[model samples]
Target: MHSVIETPMYLRAAKAAGMNDAEMKAVVDHLSMAPDDGALMEGTGGARKLRAAGRGKGKSGGYRIVTYYCGKDVPVFLLDIYSKGDKTNLTKAERSTLREILAEVANAWRESARRKAQELRRNDHD
Candidate 1:
C-alpha cells in the first residue's frame, strides 16, 4: 500500500464537509491500495479527482477528493476534499493555482530527499 499524507487543508475541508473518522479512513484505505484510482485532472500537475462515498450517501451524492501521486516512491498527498453538493468543479483560476502549489510540493519533496541522501553519505564516511 502506498503511503498517504493528508494535508492540513484537506483535514479542514473534510471536517467542514461533515466527514467522520470512518469515512476519512475509508478514503485513505482505498487510495493506499489504488493510488491511481481516480480520473486524472488536467492541468493540475498529476492531481486526480476521486469520488468517495459519504456517510449515508452513495457515490453519486458523495464527496470529491483531490489527490497528488507522482509515482510509487512519493507518498500520495491528499490536497483537498469537498462535498459534491458544494461545488461541481474547480474554476480555471483555481486549477492554475493548484498547479503552482503542486509544483512547489514536488520540488520540496525532491529537495528533502536530496538533503537526506547527502546526510547519509556523510555518515557513511565517518
Candidate 2:
C-alpha cells in the first residue's frame, strides 16, 4: 500500500466539514489500497478528485478530496478537500497552484530516491 500524506489545507478543510478521525481514516485507508480510485481532474497537472463518504452521507452527498499520486516512489498527497455543498470544482487559480505543487512534489521525491539509492550503493561497497 502507498503512504497517504495529508496536507495542512486538507486537514483544515476536513475539520471544518465535520469530518472526524474515523472518517479521515477510512479515506486514507481507501487511498492507500487504491490510490487511483478517483478521476483525473483536467488542468490540475495530474490531480484527482475523489468522492468519499462522509459521516451519515453516501458518496454522492459526501466530500470531494483532491489528491496527487505519481507512483510508488511518491506518497499519495491529500492536497485539498471540501464538503459537496461547499464547492463543486476548483477555480483556475487553484488548479494552477496545484499544478505547480505537483511538479515540486515530483522533483523532491525523485531527489530523495536518488539520495537513498546512493546511500544503499555506498553501504554495499563497505
TM-score top scorer: 1
lDDT of 2 by residue, 4-74 (tens): 99989899988998999999999999999998879999998999999998878899999999999898878
Candidate lDDT values, in order: 0.91, 0.91
Worst 10 residues of 1 by lDDT: 102-111
lDDT, model 1, position 73:
72
Model 1 / residue 24 / CA error / Å: 1.0
Q: How well is each residue in 1-126 modelled by candidate 1, as lDDT tens digits?
A: 999999999999999999999999999999899998899898887889999988789988999999998887788999999999999788888889999988888778878988999999999999
C-alpha-based local distance difference test score of model 2: 0.91
Q: Which stretches of candidate 2 lie over 4 Å from their true place?
A: 117-126
Off by over 4 Å in 1: none
